[model samples]
Target: MLDSYYLQDLDEEEKAMHEFNKDWKLSGIQRLFYNSLVKQLGGFGSEAGKFIWPTGVTNTLEGDLAIKDTGNQQIQIFSLDGYHKQTFSYGSESTKHLGDVACTQEGLFLVSDGSKGIKVFSKEGEMIHLLKSSKADWKHSYGLSVLKSNRIAVTDWTDGGKIHIVGVDWRMNAILKTNVIDGLQRPEHVAVTEDEDLLVTEGQLFGRNAGCCVKIIDSERALKKTIGPTYGDHYSFMNPSGICVDTSGNFFVADKGKNNVTLFSRDSSLSELVVTQDLEGPSGITVTKNGLLVVTDCYHHCVKMYKYRQEFIY
Candidate 1:
């Protein structure tokens, strides 16, 4: 059911087209080689294993890094050097998992508790309030993104058909916005831009074409454009679970299936391959004000940093 050699399994006409294109052939070969090496190294064999799992990562405005140890069910804070600065555990024997976390200017943090909805905690990890309760339809509340307007955007993967756009106020009160967008197969991650636009990463679930792509939504939570498909081209994504936009409006996507980070320009005209190596189950992505790219390696239980090589245009 996974898309390991999904591209190679393309129809004859599609295969013939890529066979005649040298660049396409090279890209295919590179993907195959990378996959093989990863398998031999005991990593995920198929694309499905690369994605679908949940992990959270974010960079603080003050240049600190935080990663949720989902496997360990704890939160780990690290300095810019990747040192173990401090870790907060829910309880000694508690298995309550922490999904996504966002830090506010006042050092208050908002974290999602999977199906349990959102939890507000102080800097010392003390519970402040439960923003939203778990509804039977709200299966997996995965990604969280904070906005300058103090509104929190979240992705709920419960029904696997729609995304719930809930607004939260400073008092941690939840407001169910009238804006409920449908047709989302399995919305995994959500990101908000400076312009207040919403970006979501859709993953395949239960025979749906959710994997391998992202979608943009307007301020009204209306579907704007589909970025990629289930497979093919650089535009094609595979189980893309994480998305983040830089200060320049450029979009960075973590293609879990492809084991690479893809970059798209503001106008969607320019698409380029960014990081294609040294990634193990890269689930979440965030960019720092200093232009440093931070990615979460779910299986590896650590976050990796990348320096963006900015290309200036004349």
Candidate 2:
């Protein structure tokens, strides 16, 4: 028989014993570790009447804002003035985990459900199509970005790692000629450059500390260059998650480990910290048409809006 006990009901000694158990399953141990760490950091439990943890944020063509509430397993839409409009939830309340989201020019919404590949919906929240990745090869879909040609690029974190470029046609199938790009280690998020190059934030999984970095690759899937934790003596990044490029080719990276956003020039010559603090686990980032910056605060359970300072021009 299986025994169930709530960790919150356990005393200090019981909790300590749970942590030191060598024979306990690794998944259970990791859960205990996360719980203990959250408690120690004073960030355990819910946000208490606030918005749930938002993992992805995007602006629709109609200027509405859509946010993925990972904790609540729903997508909340809001007006530009921060007024809640509507929300959509899928699957059982206990099992839904929305990973990332993006909006296309045609008023279509694309969302990744970690295990369920990608789901496309209309602006009114109507289910249009479902694009499933290869279970034999692609395991988990973590991030997604839509290109101007109606092709969607997705980051899969199953085996080794790869990016699946799918054509959003009537059947929502992947193009055979331009399919997968190999050679990535736990790629979480993806950003495209002005010249059509791809940038990916890699190596930030649980238990594996593989020195996170960003990789720039050409259309042919050749690694042109890699920017590791330290570009020079002055700056570095840890567990970088979301990445986006502005009109001028400058890159903005959300470093969740450091809780700051770092701006990098196109030539990789200059890097500086742009926004820091008042952020709890910033995961995804994007620039709107009006030049405002939007970020997802995974732990704080809200999307933050930041305006660029007058002196800092793109």
Candidate 3:
């Protein structure tokens, strides 16, 4: 839910008052009013809905959406109205393929450069830092997650699947790949909850870790639970790739094989399908601060958004 109404949503006079009340969190009544107002003004981005092999996407806390166009090797920014705002590129010999991206609290973005390492860029698209672990052997880093504590988490698909954690100071703290349930193979995508629990989409096409699933790991990197069928079923989860957690702690998993996004409640006791519109091989997914859902459609080479709704707690 929207904790505070964006001043831009209000009239000139009301927007001033909204800014004045920024120090205070809005009340439930105020939130309800703004929620309704926002819904009334809702619309999708991009009239043509165009993209070029977009593989990853993230919802910034500022409500902006960032998409990585793999085919073009460019990062495109879109406003809530679906208008293209900016385009930036960070290409180098080693950082040719920008795998995934995550937005931080201070408008900083962390971009994974496959085996080369990670590159940090400011909100204005300036290159802030390029970090590579000298100790860890990184294969193809795809999934990236920035935790509430400023810690960075990313997955290495090769070397039997591994997750490397970067401390707030931008250094490798630890590597988590062992002690995983059912043998983790290709740990492609990852998401971290407010409580520091890990949600990862892994497993190869045919192997011990076949039939991808989302595994929840505690702060200690121990497996807490798992989602998805052990064998193929309706929920297919053929290649669960991108995963994210909402403010309410609900998880949205983008299954590339299933070509859809599924929602699992905070407690993981209930699950539902929350995406089907133009989900042609949906790969990466994220929920905005106010609960708007966004996902990257790899097959369709486009990005899609929806006004997230829930009959029960998501």
The model with the greatest TM-score is 2
What stretches of model 3 exceed 4 Å from their correct place? 1-50, 92-98, 170-183, 207-209, 230-234, 310-314
After aligning candidate 3 to the native by TM-score, how far in Å is the CA of 7 from where it should be?
39
Residue pairs of candidate 3 with colliding backbone atoms: 45-82
Residue-by-residue lDDT tens digits, candidate 1, 40-153: 111222221221223677766456665555555455566665455655653221223325777765666767757545677676767677676433234566778887767677
The number of clashing residue pairs in model 2 is: 0
TM-score, prediction 2: 0.76
Report the lDDT tens digits of candidate 2 across residue range 1-314.
11135446657654443343232222111111111111001122333223566777777888777877777666677765666777776433323432688887687888886764577787888776766644323467777887766677788876777887766554444433337887788888888886778888885665435748898887677888889767654457778888887656777789888887776667665555556657778888876665556777778766676654222222
lDDT of 2: 0.66
Error of 1 at 124 (Å): 2.1
- For model 3 the local lDDT of residue 238 reads 74
Q: Mark the regions of model 2 whose C-alpha exceeds 4 Å error after superposition.
A: 1-50, 92-98, 133-137, 171-178, 205-211, 311-314
